[model samples]
Target: MTEDSAEYLQRKEFYNRMLTVYGRKPVLEVLQDNSLEIHKLHLADSNKPAAILDDMVKLAKKRGIEVCYHDKQALSRISKNSKQDQGVAADVIGKGFQSHQSFLSSNKKHYRILALDGVTNPQNVGMIIRSACASPINAIILPEKGCAKLDPLVIKASTGTLFRAPILRCKTLASCLKAFAESGADIIGLDANAPHTLGEEPLTGAKVFVLGNETEGLSSDVRAICNKHVSIPMLNNVESLNVAVTASLIAFQGAL
Candidate 1:
């Protein structure tokens, strides 16, 4: 390949691993983290003089990181959440973040991925990431849409595990699942009504346990692609467990 083509591929790979964190506090926290690989610090040009902003700039300078200023509109485009961005954003390289295709291209013979389908609550997403990180799960399939965006609340809820968690991002859960299925993965969905329990069988090969939305379980598109359905059994006439709790169970299923 030509030098320009090689450079483009390298840049694409670098960006695939980067997660842009917005909000003043979140940007500050990321800047303060010396262990993190910060690509750049972004601030709205209209931001008023403030101690925290100054601190962030100081920290970036101390770390030899680049600082960029942009108009409010341009900054919002970078942060994607104009209302909550607080006029500050930072691009932190998530060491564990990559495209699902990258993970599939790996030589690993066996792997388990926990997929979230339309789990919109940031807290729930954070808690799920925490659980997946603590367990034997290989990676998390986080769809870019129909899921909680990675923000301060999610980072806080994960107890700061979001940065270290192996997150495989995709454009849509249904499409990603279809790709996984084509690659010989067993796509399992959690349903309270399924006859089989979560740990009833020992699944081999590539496995993906999908957790659905809080109130609506799985979306119709996601449900249509599931290879099988399993439920977590409970007594006392309990119908179901929270999606986060279910994720925890699935995450630790290998241990149990």
Candidate 2:
């Protein structure tokens, strides 16, 4: 390959392995995380000087990470969500982050996977990730959108478990489930009204437990595609458990 082609390929590979984290404190936290490798740090040129920003820059300099300054619009483009990016972003290559294609290609054994559908709460997302990380599940199939962004709240809520949990990033939950189904994995959705209880179900081979939204439960698109629905047996007129709690139970059970 020509030098220009080689350079383009190198840049593409770097981006493919990176996930951009935006915001002041969040970017700073990523910089503080000794386990993570930062490919680049992005700062908006329009940002006024602040103690935290200066610390971040100092930390980056101490770590020998290259810092890039961009205009506000350009930084937004790097973050992909202008309203929420908060004028700061960093390209991180954490061990926990991986693409669906990469995860699928690397994993060849029968294992349980947690697939989140429309789960928007960062705390719940963080807790679920912690459970998955502590359990026997292979990796979490986290959609790129329609869920909580992997921001500072998630990192804090997870107690930094988010940095170590295995994750397979996808564009959408539906698309990730479709790919899992095509790969011969059983797609099971958790439902309060389902006939089968989770404890009683005979889970076999590769399976993915689809956890739904905090309030609405599963989306229609996800429900229609689920091979089976499993419920947790409860008493005392309790309607349901929190999505994160349910995930923990399922994850630990799978581990057993």
- Give a tens-digit lDDT track for model 2, residues 34-124: 7888889999999998999899899999999999999999998999878887789988885776777666776576778889999999999
Candidate 2: residue 214 lDDT (0-100): 94
Query: Which stretches in model 1 have alpha-carbon errors above 4 Å?
Result: 1-6
User: Please, what are the lDDT tens digits per residue for candidate 1 over residues 94-129?
Assistant: 879988877888856688889999999999999999
* Clash pairs detected, candidate 2: none
Model 1: worst 10 consecutive residues (lDDT sum): 1-10
Total backbone collisions for each predicted model: 0, 0
Clashing pairs in 1: none
Give model 1's clash tally: 0
Which segments of model 2 are wrong by more than 4 Å?
A: 1-16, 81-86, 202-204, 254-256
Specify the highest-TM-score model's number. 1
Residue 67 lDDT, candidate 2, scale 0-100: 95
